[model samples]
Target: MKNRSTELREALEEMIAVGTLSPGQHLDETELAARFEVSRTPIREALIQLASMGVVVIRPRRGAIVAELGPQQLVEMFEVMSELEATCGRLAARRMTVEEQQALQAAHQACKEALDSQGPDDYYYRNEAFHEAIYAGSHNQFLIEQARSLYRRLRPYRRLQLRVRNRLSNSYAEHDGVVQAIISGDGDKAAELLREHVMIQGQRFSDLMASLPQLGKQAA
Candidate 1:
């Protein structure tokens, strides 16, 4: 049962990633169960798990739906991500082994090469690897898990942002800054820089989302 639930979760996550199921769209359990050729029981369990992880929302008598990023949710998520990144940076600086530091440098350079190629797809993949390397280098299991969870939740939106105006270049510079801070073993500086870098991007996104009625207004 657990295995089926995990499989269902992965399949649904891939569906979301590929845009097969657009954000905030309704998900039918019967359709999903037939698609997966599994019992509805596993599908229900998977949907509940995804809801708990913020990947989807389940409304009473309304079935399951993909989570849409409104102005409020986006801003709140970025704030959470900012804190997580700050914690990752601090831990990476203090706990990173010599090997891990070197790997971080190499990862940054690889990402830079991808950005230099001027391909969004290549740059996006490399950028993901770079951040994952930092998360792994943090050496805090709980922090790493929390960061990964939020990261997956934000994946669709973040993927969209990679194509925003000059966002890729801007993100490259931020990644470089984080690498330098971590390599220098300056935990406080790393934490501070990470917070500013992430939070500022969140505010910028919030401003954009605010102008659209499709995205709900963020509360003060």
Candidate 2:
């Protein structure tokens, strides 16, 4: 049987991704258990795991809900994500095995091809794969795990922000810079470039919030 905790986690993640369990929205354990056809124990376990990953907040009487990233928190996320991505780039440039380097290159090229296809959605996941390849290439499992955690926490916002005007092409261009720096074995440069690259997602989200003030309301 699939692990109950994993099953619950995946179900909760899907709820968050699909807007059923929106940011700042309260999560009713009973409702979730009913919705997922699972027991409350696994639901609670999954929520606890999501909390550790910063995707949800669990309050004593108030219960758990998707995390609400305030302006300051959003900025902090951008800053932290940038630093983490840059570090991954630096480490990858220094320690990536030959096959890993090739894999990263292939991921980057695939993203490029997706971008050339000219649809926003076409390139989004491909670009994600490119960065993930870099994260793995860093040769630090702990860092990779942390980065993945943060990435998942930010996925809902990232998916929405990506749909903004011509953002896809712009994102592709940023990836180009990151790719060049990494491929050249310039660790510091790759680190700096990747840090800068990840910041664009923050900017896009910020801009979206500025316009859709309601969307910026507490995660719900």
Candidate 3:
């Protein structure tokens, strides 16, 4: 079974990712303890783990607050993410076992079902699994670790982007292309598709920027 600290950390992470706890919002240990019906020690441990993940900041005097990234920083991070995913795709195309390819397809199918039945939020979670399957297919431990770390830090923004009009459908369609390329052992094509799938540029960038204030207002 998962420990209390792990459970609390995941709960808090989801709250932040879904914008129930918006960026720059304070995380008070006392309030969190009361809310979770736990003591302060577990809350503090959870916050420390979140801090290590770049999801929250812990200051000496001010305690903990959700970490905030500027527009430029967000874009730069995505650019790096795109490159990392592209490499994963390329390697996976050449390296993935038959079993791993089957797993990736299963994950893609799960995303489709989530999109049809439960909409964007459900699709987002399944989509994460789909991408992680590709990450594991690469068989590169170091690359997988780096990709997951950045992916976790960017989870909230990525989730918010799916709220944009037609983004859910578009993302699912992109996943189709990525899956086909990898399964066909087309490394170059897989890399290209993965890069485009993850990169937030042009209108997507504008949409993300426009949506941030709305999320903040909703959180408020």
Please report, in order, the local distance difference test score of every candidate based on alpha carbons. 0.80, 0.78, 0.94
Error of model 2, residue 115, in angstroms: 2.8
Best-to-worst ranking by lDDT: 3, 1, 2
| Top-lDDT structure, candidate number | 3
List runs of model 3 lying over 4 Å from the truth. 217-220
User: Each model's TM-score, in the order given?
Assistant: 0.82, 0.85, 0.96
How far is each candidate from the true structure, as Cα RMSD in Å?
A: 4.9, 3.2, 1.3
TM-score, model 2 to reference: 0.85
Candidates 1 and 2, the one with greater TM-score: 2
Candidate 1, residues 1-220, lDDT tens digits: the string is 4599998998898666545676777999999999999989999999998999989999999899988876677788889998998999998999999998888888888888988888776776677778788888899889899998988887766665666667778988888788888989998988988887677354567544543332221111
lDDT score of model 1? 0.80
lDDT of 3 by residue, 15-79 (tens): 98888999999999999999999999999999999999999999999999999999999999999
